[model samples]
Target: MAGTTLGAASPALAQKKPEAAKPAPPKLSKPVMAVVMAVQKLQQAGDHAGALAKLTEAAAVPRAEKDDALILAKLKLFSAQTIKDNAKLEEGLTEAVEAPSITPDEKLMFSKFVAGLASNRKDYGKAWTWYEFYLGQKPDDVEITVQAASVAAALKQPARVYELLTKAIDLREAKNETGDRSWYEFRAQTAIDNKMDDKLLPSLLGWVKAFPEPKSYNLAIGLVKQRQGNLDNNVLVDFGRLMSAAGAMTDANNYLEYADAALDRGMPNEAEIVLKEGIAKQLLDGSKQNIKEFVAQAASKNAESKAGLAALEKDAKTSPRLALVVADTFANLKQYDKAITWYKTLVGNAMIDQDTVNLRLAFALKNSGDAAGAKAALANVKAGPRAIIAKFMDVVIGDAA
Candidate 1:
C-alpha cells in the first residue's frame, strides 16, 4: 500500500465545528408575568382558590392571549392537583388537548387523566371516547385495548366491546403472546348478548381450537346446540360428537338433542342407545312419559319391526347377520332378554368381534334387570378404546348401586 497523507480539510474526516450557545427562553408579556406572580404568591400561601381566581383573571387579559392557552391549562392542572379533583384534571386535559406546545408525554398524561376521571365517575361513554382517542395513537397497545373493551362493555355497547377485545386478542396472537382467558370469555358473551349470532359460534370454536380449554369447549358446543341445532340433523350430530368426546355434554338438553338428531336421521338404533346412556347418567328421562316426545315414532317402528324381527328370528337359524339384527333391534326396543340371548350367541359362536358383542350383552343384561350378568359380560371386555368406556360404566354403575 502507498503511503497517503490524509488532509484534515476532507469533509469525511473533518471534526465538527463547535455548536452555538442556545438562545434564552421567551419571556411572558408584562400582564401575564404579573398574573403568574400573583398566582405563585397565592399558591405559596396555600390559597389555591385565590390562585385559581388570579389565573382566571389573567385569562381575560387581551395581552396574555398569545400564551393564554398554556397558562390556562397549567392553572387547571395545578388546581386539579391541589384539590385532588379529577374533574379539574379533566378540564385541564380538555384544554391541553388543543395546546400547540404540549409535549407528547404531557398529551398522553392528559388523555389518561381525562379517561380515568370519566371512568371513576361511571361516565363510561365519555371514558370510551377518551380511551378511543388515546388508543387511536397506539393501536397495538393490547392492555389499553382491553381496558377500552371493558369500558365499552360497561357502557352496554356489546358490539363495541366485542370488536375491541377481539382486536386485543388478535394483536397478542400476532405477537405470539399469551392472552387472558377472560378476554376470550368477554368476547364470547359480548357476541352472544349483542345478537351477533353469526360471530358467536365461530369465535367460541376459535377459542376452543386456540386454547383447548374445557370451559371454552363447553360454551362453544352449548352455543352450537342452543342456536344452530335446529338447522339440520347433520349439524347436531357432527357437533354433538365433538361435544360428547370432549366430555362437555353435561346438559340434558344436549343429550336430548343428540338423540333427537340420531332419530331424525333414521338412526333409531343409535338414538336408542344414546337415550339409554343419557337416562343412565340421569341426563335424560327414564320414565315413559318423560321420554315420550323423544320416541314419538318408536311405537310405529316397534309395530313395523315386529314382523321384521319375526322374520329375522326365522332366518336367524341360518344367518348370524339375521341374529345380530334381532339382537340390535330388540336391544334398541328395550327387549333386553332377547337382545342378551342373541348377543351372547354371537359372542361365543359367531366369527364376529367378541368384545363388541360382549359390550352389547353387558348393556342388554344391565337393562334386563341382571346386574350380575352385566358385570360378568363387561369383565370379559379387556383392553381397547371401548374398555375405557366399560371401566367408566362399571365405576358409575357401582357408585349408583
Candidate 2:
C-alpha cells in the first residue's frame, strides 16, 4: 500500500478541483514495465489466468535494479492475491517485505499475513518463521505471541511454545494486565502434554490461581501428582487433602490413590472415608473384589482404631511420635481442630524435629481453612528439608485461600 500501485486509470479531474495526493509509484525497468502494463490490462479484463502467465514471463526477465525487483515483487503479490495462491502469496509477501522501500508497518502486516496464511495451510515451518519474525519486531504483542506459540506447537516444538507463552504471560503480568484465560491454560496444557516435569507445577499453579475452581484445582493437583515421579505418601496425602478441600476429588484414581496414601500413613479411618465417598460417587466399582476387600479392611481397621483412640490419646501426652501419628490421623480424617491440638502439643518438644511437627501443624491448620494460622505455624519450620517443604506449603495455603 505504501510503496506500490496497480496501473489503474486516473480519476477524472473536476472543474477547478485540486488533485488528491498519492504515494510515489514503484520504479520498474522498461522490460518489466511493459509486462506489468500487459498483466494489468489482462487483470482488468477479468482474464486472471492470462495475467498470471504474463507475470510469469516478467519474472524471468533480468532485473538489475533494486527498484525493478521491488516492482516485480509487488506485481507478484498482486497476482497471488488475485488468484488466492497461498504459496505464491507467502513468497511475494516475503520478497516485498524485504525491499528497502517497504515501510515498517507494511513489513509487520506482511509478516502476520504470511504467518496466518501458512498456518492455515498447515505449513508450520513457514508459519513459524514468519511468526518469529513478527514477534521479534513486536515482542510485547501478546496476541501475536500466542499465535506464534500455537504455530510452534504445530511444529512439535514444545519448548519453544513454553518459552513464547512464558514471555507473553510474564509481559502481561508485568503490566498488571489480565483478560485472556487461555494464555495460562495453554501454558499449563502444553507443560502437561509434554510432561515437562520442571515446569508443570508452576504452570498449573498459575492456571489455578487465575481461575480457581473445582475443575482447575482437580487438574492442577492431579497432574502435578501424575508427572512428579516417586512422590512420598505424605506428599500424596497433602495433594489429596488439597483436592478434597477444594471439592476437586472427581477421579477414581484420585480417590483410590488418596485412600491408599492415608492407609499407608496408618490412618485407616481417613482411608475408609475416602473409599466410601468414592463408592457413593460411583467413581469406584464396589462390585469388584479388590475394591470390596479394600473397603472392608479399612472399615474393620478404622473401627478397631476408633475403639483404641482414648488409650492412644493418653499415651500421646508423653510420646511426640504417638502425638504426631494421632495428629496426622486427625488431619487425614479432616478433624483439623483435633489435629491442630495434637500437633501444637508437639511443636516445642525437645525430643522431636520441630520443623516436621510445625510443618504438619501448618498443613492441619490450612486444611481447616485457617490460612493465617497456617502461615504462623509455617514460620516455626526454620531449616532442613522440612523447612523447604513448609515454604512451598505456605504458597499452596495462600493460593487455596
Candidate lDDT (C-alpha), each: 0.66, 0.75
Q: Pick the candidate with the highest TM-score.
A: 2
Cα-lDDT of candidate 1? 0.66
lDDT of candidate 1 over 258-321, digit per residue (tens):
8887567544755766777788888777786859656656444545666577877989977776
Q: Record all residue pairs in model 2 with backbone atoms less than 3 Å apart, i.e. clashing.
A: none
Per-residue C-alpha lDDT of model 2 across residues 1-401, encoded as one tens digit per residue: 01112122311110113438865666767887787788778878877767767777766787755567666666666666666665666667777777776667677767777777678777878877887788788888777788888888887899998998888888888887763688788888888788787797678767766666778877766665554568788667766766676678888988999999988878898899999999999999999999999999898888887788889889988888998888887776678899999988887888877877887788788878889999998889886445545545665677767
Question: Clashing residue pairs, candidate 1?
Answer: none
TM value for model 2? 0.76
Summing lDDT over every window of 10 consecutive residues in candidate 2, give the lowest-scoring window: 6-15
lDDT for predicted candidate 2 compared with the true structure: 0.75
Candidate 2 RMSD to the correct structure: 6.6
